[model samples]
Target: MYKLNVLDKLSFIFIIIGAINWGLIGLFNLNIVGLVFSEPVNLIGRIVYILIGISGIDMVLFLFKMRKSFKE
Candidate 1:
């Protein structure tokens, strides 16, 4: 089994948050991230979005790592 480190855990959390935010947008036309941050453009919001994007990439890498571990 593959163990998740701190970064991996944090990334997973962010990914879940991102997924929930998207779901809300699709189901209820709500943008939680934008609502929490400033509309149009906000530096802090942009940073958060960037972090979420990075978290998604991290998750993809984590999947590959897990797959490799399983094969081993």
Candidate 2:
């Protein structure tokens, strides 16, 4: 089993949120972030988007690190 630290857990949470948002958009044409934060293109919404992007990058790095560890 793999152990995840705080940062990994946070990234996973953000990623899951992003995925759900996308699913809503695809299935219902709804934008949850936009609804919660007002216009999805606005400042707060943009900040949330940026955080999600950073979380995705973190997850990618985590995957690489895990792959390397498993090979050792």
Candidate 3:
């Protein structure tokens, strides 16, 4: 439970940041990854994007488990 709880928190934070970044990209044509890392194709930006994708998958797993618990 401790590990999962910590992971959930971390994943949530990542997801929030990813969502906000996407919103900026969509509404203002801002390239957060590009701006921060000096280029969107940089290794750091790629890693960030990968982690964001993983966090999203983790959040979905969390939600599925939560729903299962509620159904019990």
Question: Between the candidate structures 2 and 3, which one is better when assessed by lDDT?
Answer: 2
lDDT of 3 by residue, 1-72 (tens): 224688889899999989999999999999787798876368988888898999999999998888878787
Pairs in clash, predicted candidate 3? none
Displacement of the residue 61 alpha carbon in candidate 3, Å: 0.5
TM-score of 1: 0.93
lDDT of 1 by residue, 1-72 (tens): 999999999998999989999999999999888999968649988888999999999999999999999999
Q: How do all models score by TM-score?
A: 0.93, 0.89, 0.87
lDDT of each: 0.93, 0.93, 0.86
The parts of candidate 2 lying over 4 Å away from their true place are none
Off by over 4 Å in 1: none
Better of 1 and 2 by TM-score: 1
State which candidate, 1 or 3, has the greater lDDT. 1
Predicted structure 3: lDDT: 0.86
| Cα RMSDs, all models | 0.9, 1.5, 2.3
